[model samples]
Target chain A: MSSRVRKIRENAYVMNTIGIAVFIALWWLAVEARLISPLFVASPLAVVQVLFTQTASLAQNTYITLVTLVESFLVAAAIGILAGAVTGAFDVADWVISPILDLLRSVPNVAWVPLAIIWFGIGIESQIFVSAFSAFFPIFTNTYVGFKSVRPSFIRAGYNLGASDRDVFFRIRLPASLGQVFPGLKLGIQNGMAGLIAIEFLDSTSGLGFMMGEASDFFKANIVIMDMLMIGLLGFALTMTLVLAEKRFLGWQRRTS
Target chain B: MAQGNSVLEVKNLTHVYTDSRSHVETEVIDNVSLSFQEGKFVCVLGPSGCGKTTMLNIIAGFIRPTSGSVVFEGKEVKSPSPERAMVFQDYALFPWLTVSGNIQFGLMMKNTPAKVREAKVTEYLEMMGMKGFEHKYPFELSGGMKQRVGLARALAVEPKMLLLDEPFGSLDAQTRRTMQRELFRIMAQAKKTSIFVTHSIDEALFLSDRLIVMSARPTRVLIDIELKSAKPRQRSDKEYSEVYEKVDKVITAEVSKSIE
Candidate 1:
């Protein structure tokens, strides 16, 4: 609200506007000159026209993609965080899970799409499984680190203040780990979005990924470009929503970096 | 087992830590015996790594000595119990809790009724001179303020004993002196038996009813003395200087011995 801050913010917006305009102008010029094939890459104007023409179906598919992304992420976050904490707390559990986790995490979750499809068939279950699979590793690892890396002094203080082990876990351990956990959750959501798109493109009869794939198959370059932009914007908006919520809830955290 | 005579008694306490890989054992505290009288202020002063904090940790039941017993009243100390509360050097004020909540944490652990918890929190908040900042989180406060909340939290539980591990070590000199005065005031008001660990001779001299000095590891008691004091003890006064000089020389000799 201060004049100085407002002036700097306005200057930043002006610079961003110039950068975006330059990119669009170059893209438009490339299409106009036919340096890139019009049969593949669409012009910005054509993409806008396609967005307007297919507004109803585009909105419907976007909604479906958004829901699948959220539901899968919620499931992954709940299960991953709980399991991560348990494994982190007990050395025996950590040792038991370590070798399998090492093998599984190295292989990208999107590569599990074939396995998911075979197990769940062509239903929404496949999309959810694929999305949750993509999300689980990052969230689990981060949550485990959060539990493991809690300062010994904090735990000692908890015990000195008469907290039971159960109380310490619920109160200190969980909140102390929350700083790292939020970043993991954000990364997990992004990975979840990637998996949702992959499964939807390959198997789902509906959603933005299917729309983009269908458009590409028909060689509707404008529709493909519009769908791509919508997906990018959806990912951006959802991630920013999480960032804002993190700020609101974890306002007390003083980041070292 | 004379419960009325001493609030805490540690009998021939010894601790040895074995390095995991090297299989070498280092004795931290060597055959030390001491007792804390009821409602007395006790200071344990030593060099940086001289196991004074370890001694306090043992008394507070965070650690069990490898070969001896620590009795609180008549009960043997096995684990950290509500009867002994600690204030750490780093303050250790919970980051997520507001000032009021941190102070109430002990009472919450005790499962005190909501009404009493609220009243007790307000009482300690005012006692620590932290009235209006009850809702402010730890990150919002300055170092001295955070330690005040830490003190408030420790004392709120009304523990039979208080353990302070260099509680003012992080503060600037002026703030440290101010906290020392505040600590004296709080201790006088509460009348809890306190075990304070510090390296500063003046801090040990000014605050203690009994001061115990320790040598470097394997640590052993170097000097134990009781003081006669009329507090608001002026630091610049002749008697204060005399005691300070004596304590300083004793601790400095130990520090030099450690280096040699």
Candidate 2:
């Protein structure tokens, strides 16, 4: 059984490689056969060529975008988790805040972008505000659900074993909630990334999104595609990092029914 | 050792559970009165969902009785205390904690000195036959192993009594049998008062010195009998079979009534 599982895991990576290879081969063929206009869609070779030629600018913009995303996401996560824990732990707080939260969350995060820009003046603050706003709802909602969903048996055991209300909250409820919190953090980061790009299109002088906007205006399809791929790679890397962290922290959850 | 001294007493205890949405109140325990003797392994046998768990929870102080009281060592039991550590059927060992960490939890809650906590953790680990599994998480252990850790954690607190809510119910038959023997051995050594609740008459027969058979809801004590058969009693023997038949008749009647 162990050997078969190991074989399947090894084959998974191989399959992923083959799948990507097939996709790129089809794209290359399409470009080579003039199936699309180069002005609209850059060939894979052209995108790669731009990667080499604009390495310095691309790297700097990528760094800026990454920094903005991380900082704003951290802000959202800290407040969201605190708020979630509080509301989840207390019945009165849940009753008072739940409806208000529902009202605020119903407004699409994208709808906040123009107001954020107006309030914070097209600066980094505007980018942070929009990104943090977008990220907060998922983190808060999921964290609340995480805390609420803790098994009643655990709480009973905690109380029976002499845990005070405070001890049960921190030791039992908070730690148990972590398994659900990670997925929220993953969604938060993705939402923050989207918000960062949207704000960057209107505000930032330095970011992959701004670079893409600038390149597209100049009809540099290759640079535009290259920027999109860089953003995609960054998002994928961030998500993978969260996945590894979740595994590290919630290792006991593995193979759980 | 069933000493004449009582460790705890329930005085006309009754509990009614109310559904929040429906506002319907169900009287689960109806004027039940019982007492646990010092250092005796007592088991409460009843039909399934006969409020056996409710009675256990009240005794554990996890829930308040609608009327009457539970007194432990002359003090009224108002809320959960370390004095009565409970072992849940689900083996609610903190999944995040290692075996040693779980065993050490109650002691840590009491603010025991670090050295004392470490020593108690080590002692319980050895007692539960989980010495090498100290660093293993609950998920890494089998159903039986998890309950052993649960038992160890409860015992490490040095509570006045152990309240087990069908601790071995979820284990497979083979594992459950092994655990019953292990528990018998541990209780002999630890000598703490215990109140074990189970639907299985066989389990109660195999474990308890004093057996309390409860009826279906609204539940009351049907009979409280002393099993004078010696420890490690042979189930095939005439004495064991006789007691089993007596208890089986009471339980089977109750089960059918509940089904009807």
Candidate 3:
């Protein structure tokens, strides 16, 4: 809250606006100068016009993609939390299962696209599986670390207070691990989104990714550009909502920043 | 089995462990044996890294001594139980819980009636001098206040004894002084048999009825002296300085030897 810090932050916002304005100005100039064909990269004005005019279709596709991303992410998160807690709570469990998880997580999720398509027949199940696969790692790894690194004193305190094994996990372990868990969930969301878009691009689909793929095939650069812009906006909005929800749940945690 | 008025006893306790990384064996606690009666404040003083914490943890039943036993109320201590509660140096107040919630935690775990829990929490809140701030989170409180809450939480459970590990070690000198005074007053009110561990000789002299001093790693009792001083004992008193210098001299020598 120092005056200097406040001034610097205000200038940062000003610079961000300037950066956007400059990029758009350059884009318009490039199109006007005919330096590149608009068929490949549409002008900002054309993309915005398309974005506004195709609002209904855009909303429908966006909703479909959003639902698939969210459902998969939720399932992945639930499984990750349970499995992570098990690994974190018991060293034997970690030794037995962690290597397999690490091995599976190491592969690129997009590589599963062909298998998913073959197995689920280009249906929503394949999209969801891909999304879940992308989202699972961050949550799992972070939750495991979170459970492992919980201050020993808190666990001691719980037991000293006569908490049973069950009470320790549900009452002390889970709630205490949540601070570490939130960052993992946040990372998982971003990864799931990237995976969702990549998978959508792979085959027959109804979401924004499919629309973009179809448009690009016919060289509808304006529509493709608008769809890409919509994807970025959706990611931003989802993350912001997550950050707000994170604050509501984990605001009590001591934040270094 | 009833040792008359001997509420707790530590008999021939010894512990050894290897450094996980170094893989070299070391004895952290060497055949330590000591005990205290009910309602007496015992302060443990030792050289740095003297395994005072390890000993306290054993007595709390958080860890078992490699050999020997801690008997409380005629039973060998098997595990951590509500009968013995600890006040930790770092406060250890759950970050996600409010002041009242943290204080009432033991009671909730024990399945005390909500009505009784509410009453006991309120009582301890006032006892620890942290009234009217029940909803504040641990992050909101200062070091001294948070330690007070930690103490209140421990006391709220009505544990038979209290174990404190450097509870005021994190506070500034000024806050430490104030908390020491407050803690002394609160201990007087509860009159629970308590063992406090500290690096400060002055803290030991102020709070303890019996001072137990220990040496560095593989620690053994070097000096066990009864500090017969009345409550609210003056820091500048003749006897106070006498005991302080005696304990300080013994610990200082051990500290030098341990370094070598």
Clashes of each: 0, 0, 0
| Candidate 3: stretches off by over 4 Å | A1-14, A52-57, A254-257, B1-4
Worst 10 residues of 2 chain B by lDDT: B231-240
| DockQ of each model vs. true complex | 0.65, 0.71, 0.72
lDDT of 2 by residue, B1-260 (tens): 54879989999999899999999999999999998899889999998999999988988888999999999999999899888999999999899998888999998889999999888888888888878887888888999999999999998888989999999999999999999999999998999899999988778888889999999998999989888878877789676798789889988998899898
Judge candidate 2 at residue B136 and give its lDDT: 89
List pairs with backbone clashes in candidate 3: none
Cα lDDT tens digits, model 1, B134-221, are: 8999988888999999999999999888899999999999999999999888877888888999998878877888888899888999
TM-score of 3: 0.95
* Second chain TM-score for model 3: 0.96
Across residues A151-170, which tens digit of lDDT does each residue of candidate 2 receive?
99999989988899999999
TM-score computed on alpha carbons, candidate 2? 0.95
Query: What's the C-alpha lDDT at position A100 in model 3?
Result: 96
Candidate 2: C-alpha lDDT: 0.90
Candidate lDDT values, in order: 0.89, 0.90, 0.89
Please provide, for model 3 over B57-76, each residue's C-alpha lDDT reduced to its tens digit, 9 standing for 90 to 100: 99999888889999998999
* Least accurate 10 contiguous residues by lDDT in model 1 chain B: B1-10
